[model samples]
Target: MTIDAKRIVVLVPARNEEHSVADVVLEVSAALPGATVVVIDDGSTDRTADEARRAGAVVLSMPFNVGIGGAMQTGFIYARERGFRAAVQVDGDGQHVPSEIPRLIECLEEGADMVIGARFLGRGDYRAPLLRRLGMHLFSAALTVLTRRSFHDTTSGFRATGRRGIEFFARTYPSDYPEPEAILLLCRAGYDVREVPARIRERESGASSITFFRSIYYMIKVLLAIAMGMTRRAPVRRRGEER
Candidate 1:
């Protein structure tokens, strides 16, 4: 299925990813020539914004580091404001393959409110370490129970969403560890969520924010957020409202 590039936006959220952002932005532009590429520079002390801009991507620099969730929500707000029909999110760390973005958009075109590009769903060389894999499994199980849906890779950040999902998230998004919880949020809000197999590469540079201790904290914090989300009411979509 072919989609109008003008109707789609590739949102790259970066922080101190100067080494990798340029290549990622270039690859995304090559993969989808006409799509708008926007890099949310999450207050990087490095030259992330400069590299992204040089690579032909529109840069939105945050005043301070707002983490992944805040950066992504800012991108969604941009998409909504610009009247984009769809939005695809790929990490700026060079882990997610830009070429696979089409596969995610295909699912979205087929009627999925949101499509997750899952790493563990198929045979591949990208493997998380034992401890990290265990943490992922625990969260995947928790999401499955909460949403009553099978989820193989809840932590996958490679995802695409249609207008409704983008608009909904722009209004209210989780602050920390938003990927898995965002999926559950869409499901509870009556949106169709789907997943497909995709590949991941090792980061080109820089250390991961998730450490042995931080991964544990991430699990606890995300789980609590998901539980709280279940009890809260989703906002009603108001028509004729400006994005």
Candidate 2:
């Protein structure tokens, strides 16, 4: 399929990534010219919104500071309303590379409901923090048990989902610290998930929301969310497809 017919959109949910958002947006836009790009500015106190818009993305600014989950859910809503065939979540912090987008687009074309960029599939160049890696491993294991399928990179933000996945997330998605548990949520809704090989860069600037104190808090919160998503599951039935 040509890029225009695919209706693929790149969703960038940014908080305070003012320094990186501009360059990232421009690069993604150039990489996928036919694809529409939307940047959700989640109430950043800096020039995130202005800079993102100037960089040539369709900017959506939230009135209040919602978390990453909220910002991404908003992007899902946009895709749903705009009749986009697929939506790919890209980090505005310059971690995810734009050149790898075609592989994700190919995944959607190949009939997978969701495709995640696995940083550890064959490369560990991202060099995630030790504690974060532990958290990801633990969550990946727990989610594998819950989903009854192999999911290596549960915390990977580089994910592409089709219209069904977009619609599902528009109605329900993670609120805070949503990386790992969000996969469980997608599985309970009956979407088939796959992981792809991709590399990520370290953050160029700014600070992560997951500080030492918040890391502990996030681990507990995500654990609770995983358990809750498993119990409170309802399949989205589309002509008995269960996807």
Candidate 3:
């Protein structure tokens, strides 16, 4: 079960993404040569697991569809357990471009525990709906006020994490609406989280998992989660005491 720690691994969390998983895997593999790509097929009823494997990725199929947060946590656990030095979270929906992975990794190598490939930091082709854009701004402002750090996109899932970040999330990751909450968790634990501008391609196939109706609920849940996170204390781990 020994894997190369020198190579940065790309972790893809997928659910019923039969149409796009293979392409994502191949692009990731090509984009980061020698880097291992693993797919967490989150209880997909389609051929996601098989397609990913056929595309030359190590696939871990979940028995049930945990939300995106849970699936990502699983990937972190896998990466940490295998002694990977770092991991990049790439979506199976094809929105996250593989070519931009190195930029995220560069930031990670420059001493950031977490590097978020932010969509709104610089000009990009990504254009969320007006309502979604407003919600993003609200979350960003709230996070900035609470954390004392500027946050442009609190909901972007495209990110990379160093070993410390991976281990931290492996131990205590949020299961629901994790992106925004994760920033708070890492900052509380004394980890450096940075953001780099990256572009996102609109999905050409399949509907997004989050619907318009669910987005309202998602916003409310995330805000409450962030508020609760502020009051809580992050557990500090002693050196060599990792579980």
Candidate maximizing lDDT = 1
TM-scores for candidates 1 onward, in order: 0.95, 0.93, 0.94
State candidate 1's TM-score. 0.95
Summarize candidate 2's per-residue lDDT along 42-158 as a digit string, tens digits: 999999999999988899999999889888989998999999988999998988888888888788788878889999988647777888888888898999898899888888899
Better of 1 and 2 by lDDT: 1
Off by over 4 Å in 1: 239-243
Quote the lDDT for 33 in model 3. Answer: 85
RMSD of 1: 2.1
**Whole-model lDDT per candidate:** 0.89, 0.84, 0.87
lDDT of 3 by residue, 85-156 (tens): 889999998999999988888888788999999998774778988778888898899888988888899899
Best by TM-score: 1
Please write out the lDDT profile of model 1 over residues 1-243, one tens digit for every residue.
Answer: 456888999999999999999999999999988999999999999999999999999999999998899999999999999999899999999999999999899988899999999998883578887878998898889888988889999999999999999899888777778998899888888889998999888888888779999988998898888888788886466543432
Candidate 3: worst-modelled 10 consecutive residues by lDDT: 234-243
